[model samples]
Target: MTDVPAHVHEFDWPDRVVIGTVGLPGSRTFYLQARTGRRIVSITLEKEQSALLAEKIDEILDRLREVEGNRYSVPTSTPVELVDNDPLDTVEEQFRAGTLGIGWDPTTAQIILEAHPLPADLDEAEEFDAAASVNSEMLRVKMPVGTARAFTQRTREVVDAGRPLCTLCGHPIDPDGHTCIIPES
Candidate 1:
């Protein structure tokens, strides 16, 4: 609700926006990347954050579709043409994301996502507001509904590509070994 901060890396209708990662499954580091033409911004985030971001975006789209006229053109699934299965372009961490924001813009019918850097004071991390007009650098991206759907699809795939889940205890099975310890009933 404030002026666009000078530290904000804003991408309006980016050419490409995705959640990608580097390193192997268990030790992998997730990144949210947005590119408009030659300019690209990559920010590091947690694997769980990536998963939740995708899920929330999809939920927003689903709710938008349920609107009476369905005029937003929200896709039920990722359009085949927008599917991006390629690896990340390059690895560069602009910042470590501590807070994330997601919302819809009715005028443009675009989904907006913002990633804010972690606070210097670990104790104040909980109080940092990503949406507030603070003098902090952040990455903000707005993409159409189709691209949003595609982004969520890719994000879910990337998150799932990590360690497999144990059938019994429902915990990730690490590469070395996994012991599923069932709790007492």
Candidate 2:
């Protein structure tokens, strides 16, 4: 695998927006921004829900354009009356079932999710391995090209901050001191 370009960087919370794709057909792309911390997420779907979502986005952009400034106000979500099933619940279930693969870039504070075929059972090690490899490949290939700019900007900030903490010990140390305690035979 090619190294993630030097430009890709980590993101800070609240200030960053994450974009990703989801659903079985891989047709749904979701753009989520964290509000009031990561607990409250505002989502904007693109090229997924198709006509309805497109219409809503167009309406919002139109209204914003009318204001003659880069900024405009729009409702984050619309309340929907469900007769029986909750859409959010269904979506959550699919996520938990591994029908979705969620990727989060800490530097850019962006999340990318894609609809993927999952292993039939978590206990099946062989199947899990195959599924995981496929998922990883898909992520590398399908990652949005547009996010590179934001990712690069965030990475620069992180690099300026200094080196990362040790993944094994979670301790911050100078590069020369970064040794794993695990003995090699």
Candidate 3:
């Protein structure tokens, strides 16, 4: 087996970028893809990674709009769709996310996202150094604010398409049965 490389890659303005999933609902695998012409880079990340990115993006855009109002800058609206040619156009992942960083580029009106790999979750063990695990590798993707917002919105939609949650408990309701927490009558 080949070892994963450690490096930072920058995609200034990719032709297409999308977050999508594969497999059945209970076993879906979340992946992020960025394509420039024929060049394609696909990275698989935990579901939480995608969800958090979406949340952060919404938060950032909201804050930016509040600060700048309709005055600062935003490309005119267009249909927001997650576009990808054949899911997993590439087989292997550049890296799975350990941590992700998001930022707004005022000059270019771009939303920048940097994904770092985590070899181990900190809560897994005391020996696991979260900081050290964080800097293992980085994959940075930069796209316009409109595109970023679209991706975030579509990603959240895809994520929420999973199993339904129990009304009594926030946990997913298994197909077999849900161990819901309810007050005894």
Candidate 4:
């Protein structure tokens, strides 16, 4: 058995970072890709994870904007020039993301995102220390306010582009058919 080197694909300021999918809506595979120039890192993620990440990022930015004397320039919406709607570049799955983390960086006024690979031992504790997880492979990304806003905007659009919801049960309707289990009144 050979050892796989623990790699940390970090992008301080990427030119493009977006959540995109491959395949049809119901059977689609979600991916989080970040690129700086020619270097690109793509990590597979679940649809729920992608949606929650975007929501949390927006919540953080919204809170920051409400700060009484906020020195940072937090945009209320994605900058017109920064709005990215292009398809993801050729994806090469580096790993399937298990633990996704996001935070705000005040000093640089950037949003930080980290994606850690699934642990080898499924039974082990899931808590992760980004600084201490040196033996694992992960991707770390930092982006400014404008870029972060754009990311969340694009991500929301991608997530919503999936199967339409059934108004009766609020569940996604399948392409073939949908059996909504309507609740008894």
Stretches of candidate 3 above 4 Å error? 1-6, 69-72, 75-88, 120-136, 175-185
Evaluate candidate 1 by giving its C-alpha RMSD to the native, one decimal: 2.2
Name the TM-score of candidate 3: 0.77
Tens-digit per-residue lDDT, 26-95, candidate 4: 9999999999999999999999999999999999999999998767889999999999889999999998
Ranking by TM-score: 1, 4, 3, 2
Q: Stretches of candidate 4 above 4 Å error?
A: 1-5, 121-134
Candidate order, lDDT descending? 1, 4, 3, 2
Each prediction's Cα RMSD? Answer: 2.2, 17.7, 4.9, 4.1
TM-score of each: 0.90, 0.22, 0.77, 0.88
Instruction: Looking at model 4, report the run of 10 residues with the lowest lDDT sum.
Output: 125-134
In terms of lDDT, the poorest run of 10 residues in model 3 is 76-85
- Summed backbone clashes in each candidate are 0, 8, 1, 0
- Candidate 1: deviation at residue 159, Å? 0.9
Q: Name the lDDT value of residue 37 in candidate 1.
A: 89
lDDT of 3 by residue, 1-185 (tens): 54343566678998877888887777889988887888877788888888988888877777777774645455333234534334556646776776678888887878899877766555765674546655466778888777877777778877898889877767887677778787778
Tens digits of lDDT, candidate 2, 31-109: 3332233333333433333233224333433444465443322223321321112112112221222233444343443
Clashing pairs in 2: 9-155, 10-107, 10-108, 11-106, 11-107, 11-108, 11-109, 18-110
Candidate with the greatest TM-score versus the true structure: 1
Best by lDDT: 1
Positional deviation of 41 in candidate 1, in angstroms?
0.4
